[model samples]
Target: MDSPSSSTGPQPIVNSRPGGRRRSILSDFLSDSLPQPSSFLSTSPGIAREILTQDIAECSSSDDDDEQAAASDAESASGPADAKLAFHPNGIVWGAGCSLVPTHSRDRPVPNPHEVEESLHAELSLLRDNAILPPKHRRPRTTNAFARLYRRNFSTKVRDHEGPIVPDVAVETTPMLREIPPTPGPEEIERRFEFAVAHHEIRTTWQREAKTLIQYSTPLIATFLMHYSVTIGSVLTVGRLGLVELAAVNLATMTASITCYVPVQGLATCLDTLCAQAYGSGHKHLVGLQAQRMTWLLWILMVPIALLWWFSEPILAALVPSKETASLAATFLRVLIAGMPGVAMLESGKRFVQSQGLFKATTYALMMGAPLSFLQNWLFVFKFGWGFVGAAAAMAITQNLLPLLLVLYVWLVDGSRCWNGFSRKALRNWGPMIKLALPGMIMIEAQFSVLEVLTLCAGQFGTSQLAAQSILVTVTSTSFNIPFPLAIATSTRVANLIGADLSQAAKVTAKVSIIAACMVGCFNLLLFTTFRDLLPRIFTDDVEVIRIASQALLVCGVMQVFDAIAAVAHGLLRGIGQQAIGSYANLFSYYLVALPISLSTAFALGWRLTGLWAGITVGLLCVSVIELAYLHQTDWEVAAAQAADRLRSEDVAEVKLRRHSHSSYHMEV
Candidate 1:
């Protein structure tokens, strides 16, 4: 957060002086201890002054040619800063003179890499020992290759320019100077330098980042799979009740998911950012408050959705060719209305715990709830002879049951501190939350509604094809669960890298993620191809349903890679703050390309279920291709700059709010 000073001294080497000034130990230790100031600091305040000063003092630009060269250099440097502030966690301004460090270039002498490593280690120890930043806010440690390279590049720039850490300041008696740490001896510095450069290759960064991604995503994958199982359980149990029943359940769930479940999940996503910021900023109760607000908002929103469900039979009848299927779907939706509040709370509560880094809360709840849902489905549908109605009832009960388990886990185990019990506060200040919720809901809806549209289109082909559509939806959704969570993890990682001003590292991570996604896609592709005959049997036993699904499974198999790529690309777009591009691309590709191709081929050309999936497959391909192109063309450096600006703006807003009053400012999530 350091601002450049106009009257700063010429760059001075850590242990040397051009005017025979006495070299100070404290300056040298600080030079070695603080991580290198970012090369992207040319946009900071007073940088123009610094550049003009250097041009006048050093270039002696009496000639227009020399003046033009300096002007060009200044032009190149003038822009919004892309780098984050290099302020120390304990409030030390170690990078006070960062703007004065000549921008990195090929001409700069490479500093001893060992010295760089040791210097970074010292600063990392400082950050760790102080514990000023919570776990969520901690940047990557010095062990990361990119982090080391940043330190190395910083050392080279400061050494080449001889810029002081703080311009024109007394090393001794400086404000907030701590006891000087011991400096390395000549032998130690030389030895470490040799060691650093000798081992400077960052070959391990890929492996290290990959390992980190896998480890972080593993729990999420499990959690998402179990969550999906709740619905899959219903599909499996309901599919056993005969072809009509299976088709009814499929139609019902599709209606519920697109109209209710997906939107609720999407709106709840706002808390991912809101609650995390609250927890990281030490407002733990704000996390719960935010969740409560979202829950209430969703419940209020649900009033209309519930009403729609209650009267949806006519709507479904108009859209779907099978009036019987439409009526059954309406019945299922009406039954599901009883669980709307529970679904809202569960989605909100998941974010509540996830933001606190306690992912296992939802996992544990689903661990018990998933099987119980399955058992309930069995009892109601077969043992209890309730048929399709029984399956709907079981799913509704399970939906309600999940939030209770989540609440119990919070109260009994960890994450209880965030909750302060019910208050009218939850009912107040719905604007900011709504603003974030609407866009997220729209984005998620855009992604999911296309699939439901395809289902509606499939309903024209007869119940067998509709049942096959259900089987296809179930298989693909299950497959999608894996990469979707992985994509979330990727988004978090890439965002962290961008925020740290490590664009090169962020690019590397994006590559790794895309590669991982491709691998996952291929794995899914192999499974679908290999098990196409057997996969449908898990859901139903009707010969025609399985046959239609099997033929479509080939199309679904081809779609996997594209679907996987699209999922990861969406995540990558989110990480770089370019999700608006993705939102547009999804709407364009699905509605224009996928829908047209699907309708024309299915109805116009009489291609049946295969044509439906064929259209979706092409849409997936279009989406993936567009997303990847955008990601490829994006200037990561600018993205990082914008991210820093956003973070700074948020901090400024928070500070202004805190300055006015602690309690009077309406809390906006």
Candidate 2:
């Protein structure tokens, strides 16, 4: 044999017996006669098996094996041969050399199996004793049956390929042969665990807030829808009476809404800030007292409003073109005056319950009241022939019952914990409530006055136009009930967050509310736009009214988006105790920006009813823009602090009033 060339790298060891093929160096070295105990390689059995299998597969595929053997024989004849061996111990190669001994005989004596076994055992013991081999427990575990099967199939496929190529004999260390990576340290383990926990917590908090918003808003929206049905029912009943009656009732209803109903409703919203903050801060008793104070204040305010309703004919006459229409509207207003207190009281009770997060009670009360009011309208207007007067009476009676039902539910069913019973102390805290109520009242009044002005302008177009305007306003207002409760819920939820001193949470709530409102606005736009031709027919069957109202409905479809934005923004301001800013924005937008545009378009430019609505649209757009801009710039942390201060200041004032009362009593005694 000739010495293997140095540049040939490692060669596979072959069995020199007559028909035996080449085998891997690892298996050959283990099977060969060792010169000494130290000459044997040490490696895991699994790796040794893999290397053997790979080399055998490569040798089986080579066509040049005969040529290589002939070249080796020529080299052997020309020069003295040395055997070069490459040992792979645990898959790491180590170079070695040994002299070759040639045998001319065809047969060589086979090594005894017993002697070979003893030699292998002796070599393993020596390696273990010398610490050259790893301890048994430290060795890598062998591959299971699945891994062996995969390797067998893979090797079979690689060997059967038909090609002209030289096979390379090399054992590349794979992942199986490499040392196992060290276990992670305690610090890294802790860091990974903490990251997992934080990720879970963030996911959980988001789900919780989403659930809370849904739970709070759903019942509120339902309640608003039910309550709005009462107004729709009235409009539908009055429409059956005749065109003049429908126009009269619509005019009176809108006027009352602006002058009496909305003002009280606006004034009562002060409870949203007061009662919501009180309940959230755990001053539960203050919630009830705030409710009572709102009731008293609203009742007092209702005095002048009743006078306005009684004398509304002259007002309507001056604004409306038809004297008969004004007289019918006045009659309707006078009938509704008796129910103004009921409306005020009902709103106060609603705020009190809503502040405590008892939205379901409001929903239940409105559900009952809406149907009963509708039934009563059918009975009084259609069955008993009470006409517009019956519609107003039915509404007044239902309105009176609504507050009583809400109050009874709150006191007897749930929310009694917040009520300390009726208290004179509620009557004493007028100044603080008024301070908050005034700005809110101003903001609401400005918007309502714009609608009233638009209604007046619509009246100038004629009875048919006025009837159409009424139908459009009623439909739009009904649609408005959807986003309105969202605004109320936003206010309550934001106030609660502020009262709890969760500044970032309040900001998030505000943003979520605005986005939700805009989505609802889009929905309303689509709804009204799709049904513009059909919706007016619900209130009136008159062809002319339907045609005129359809045109105005288009304007309403565009306006609803801006209206929703402004409504929610106003609610946010109330929540953050910034009602004055909303008031100013409303004043400027409605009076300066919207009113002039509306007047010039409807009268000077002759756009009529459509132009009036166009003007209203411009006002709503201005208010929405201004208020949203202000909201974007607000610092929620400061707003939260202000809410806290507002609650504390009221407490301080209550204390001073008590002290003064006690001193006066002592002096008198």
Candidate 3:
């Protein structure tokens, strides 16, 4: 939300400095808060109406007779003016019945292990005093169900969630025009366009796509936090059990997560994008059909997945170093994997619902899952004699319970029946889905592979290094997610636009997404740059790890823009069903290029961790650059023609099939 500013003295009173030298707190806060004072102050005079009444009251409380004595309180309250904001130290600027948070502070300082614990007491008090979210809404949102569980017992409903919660809007919204032009005058339209462009450039310099950045990047942050939450619990419970338990738990989680999730997530995007497209095109059946296929596919996948669950220990042994690890990983993996069906169902169901613009379902499901997962984890790991295995079981058990119920819940609501009547066309829709899906899968695989190598490399440095790497990885992952939700939203928009025959608008939306990503990337770059030294202390006190992690942050931090570009490019293409291209880019970048280079550098060249990180840089940079270039060179008109051609081909294929009176694959399975 802010960066440390040089002191701006308090506002001038009647007896204050004669030269107006005591700069108003306004100078500290607003001067820094506004993108450009000249434009923002008058650009939208009504903005003052939108200030949070609570924040205003908090600010207005400054009339406390001893306000001057609490100037530090004032400064702290007004910290958004100058002090650099991180996720923990949220800053707000309040005065004159208004509050300003220059940005959603993305820098999450890794807390020392005890700091979070200490905060728990205060958090508990708040919980005791404050109101809970509506009982129906009290559960965590779907995307975050598992993680939210960690905070359930310790957390209160009192603290506001950091992200912008999309409240249910009952007002009718049917694609209304959203243009709010700069205060217009005799200014030429073209000139006005130029001016708007220039103004955007300047303001965006300090702020990225603040909203979008926060949206997409929150997942990454959540990922980082997830590692910590799991690690904190595991380490506390398992650390005393010895290194073997720790290693076993880690290995078990990794193998299952990589095998279970990475590919699944990539493949699931098809549902997200296609469903969005179908919804946009008003082809209701496609959305439901795709969801059914995905659900059935999960069922099919579950057979093999459950087998692995049955044999999880051996798999852990194969992947990790120790027999003890094998035993530990296997024990945990089995339980966790048992929950795999639920996890898959939950995710797929969410994508289905989210695609159909029923975002509430996903949120509601998460709300339920969070506390349940946490309580389960606690009981199994701590109360039961399960150790790391118990922790894993907790996760699995809760996971297992959620999905089937959700499926049935939706079905009971007539969702399942909605897909009952499948047209013959519904029986034959796999080709395009797979074609558009592979690239995303490839990218996910490539990324997970990179992470595996990096984790392995970090292993050589010892546990502290691994923990630090995990910490930073979590931070960046979480930060990067700032744009991801936006990317998802953008994908939906792109599908809608493309479906509606607005190719140019689709292109514009893609461009808008990229620009938004870059701006977010830039702001985050600034955040990491400013807080590089501060972030390492959050995880551990090991001085060597801090120094090493800080250096890694420096090198890796600058590449976020490239990552942003690459990710959004992939998202855009996939939305248009050009997934294989992005997949290929990912494959080439990570496998044919980054892997070899980074491995050789880290191991062969003796560059150590730097080499490992450099590889990620090279791969991501190459991917981003080449992908952007490809996007730039895209001939959408030709592509649009090709879309029509493909549809024509499908039509012909359908006609031939009907003419031949061929049977379908519906009976095969």
Off by over 4 Å in 3: 1-249, 266-327, 351-357, 382-386, 408-447, 460-464, 498-508, 529-551, 575-577, 640-669
Q: Can you tell me which runs of candidate 1 are displaced by over 4 Å?
A: 1-204, 663-669
Ranking by TM-score: 1, 2, 3
Query: On a 0 to 1 TM-score scale, where does candidate 1 land against the true structure?
Result: 0.70
Which one wins by TM-score: 2 or 3? 2
Against the true structure, what is each candidate's TM-score?
0.70, 0.62, 0.55
Q: Write the per-residue lDDT of candidate 1 for residues 431-515, one digit (tens) a residue.
A: 6667655766777677678778888888978999999998998898888877776676667667655654545456656777888
User: Cα lDDT of all candidates, in order?
Assistant: 0.63, 0.60, 0.48
Strongest candidate by TM-score = 1
lDDT of 3 by residue, 462-487 (tens): 55555455556656665655554455
Candidate 1: which pairs clash? 11-162, 12-162, 114-192
- Number of the predicted model whose lDDT against the real structure is largest: 1
What lDDT tens digits, residue by residue, belong to model 2 across residues 1-669? 111121111221111345432221122113433221111111112221222222223222333432332342353334311100100010000000000000000000111122223323322322232233333333333445554443333221111112222333444446665554443333433343234323321011122233445655566566656777777788899998788888898898888877877677667756655655444333455567678878988888889888988987888999999998899999988998888878888778876776555646766777788889999999999899887899989988988988888888976898776676776666674765676567556656665677777788888888888898889877777777666666655665565555545454455556567767789889989998999998988888888889988888888899889878887787776566565566678778878988888889989998888888888789888888776666654545455556556556544543443344334334544
